[model samples]
Target: MPFRAQPLRLVPVLAALLCTAPAAAQMDHAPARCTAPAGLPAPMASWRNPLALKAGADRKAAARAILTPGRTVTLALLPTPKVAYPVRPAKPGDSVSHGGLASFTVKEAGTWRVALGSGAWVDVISDGQAATSIAHGHGPDCTGIRKMVDYDLKPGRYTLQIAANGEDSLTLLVTRLP
Candidate 1:
């Protein structure tokens, strides 16, 4: 028999399942429990996304944290062969296809908020984890989102590039701090 049987029968089952101690009635509740993702590193243990961003259809997913320097023997590598879909396999430090995502090597791993100059959608790829599940800023007069990353950085060179449609109208300014 199909599970989509009587709708009335299902009501009671759902009600019972949802009927946990009402928080108002309970008076006291502990804390909510959660599992962190495997890839996140230390610097980002406290990572949180203010805006809910979804991993792009072609991009990978990230935990709240990321990789760290010195502590990292290996890293989450991204295979950025083509900007198109059905991405081909890649290695660590692959460049973004559309030049939309900027490739940077952070020292540690954690959730980092990206600051964009304008309200446009900016792609960010860190240490090869899927580009962070964030769309570019889209508020009034928002150019692009830009900010520092959570990965503890080492003394190394990184790349920041924007996607181009063979035409250029905007520019991205990138700087690193000590």
Candidate 2:
């Protein structure tokens, strides 16, 4: 008689295979833990230690803090209604939101980046007009930055307006692209 296949004998073999499947799958698809980049870019590295300042309610108050390129500042914002943007934000926040104004002088004309730790509207204003934005994107993963906006700026004083932020404080950085 020909040898017959035995179902009972295969049960133990199937059970062993099933038990190891999950472990093998996990080894293949396990997510990697998030860690800072091996070496952070200059602008991103500045976020590690941020200077604290109060956001200005209006043009007058904005003079208190001078935003510098290549550095990060944490601004304490005010109620949206209290902020008087030199030029209206392209995306205006509701009254319940928070906002503020700060000023920065660009000694060199170039493409400058404005990075924010929250989803806030940023408008760079010079001579009472809004500078056109060149680019918009999210910051690097694992960094607290949520948004980044770029503008082509000329050497001069500009108003950095923060609007429509959900929180009363925001971390901001201005860095020039080489």
Q: Candidate 1, after superposition: displacement of residue 32 in Å?
A: 38
Candidate 2 clash pair list: none
Question: What tens digits encode model 1's per-residue C-alpha lDDT throughout 127-155?
Answer: 44335342332212221222232223344
Tens-place lDDT digits, model 2, residues 11-50: 8999999999999999987544576544457756888689
Model 1 stretches with alpha carbons more than 4 Å out? 1-101, 126-129, 134-161, 164-178
lDDT assessment of candidate 2: 0.87
lDDT of 1 at 23: 53
* Candidate 2 lowest-lDDT run of ten: 31-40
lDDT of 2 at 16: 99
At residue 71, what lDDT does model 1 achieve?
22
On TM-score, the candidate that comes out on top is 2
In candidate 1, residue 41 scores what lDDT?
A: 29
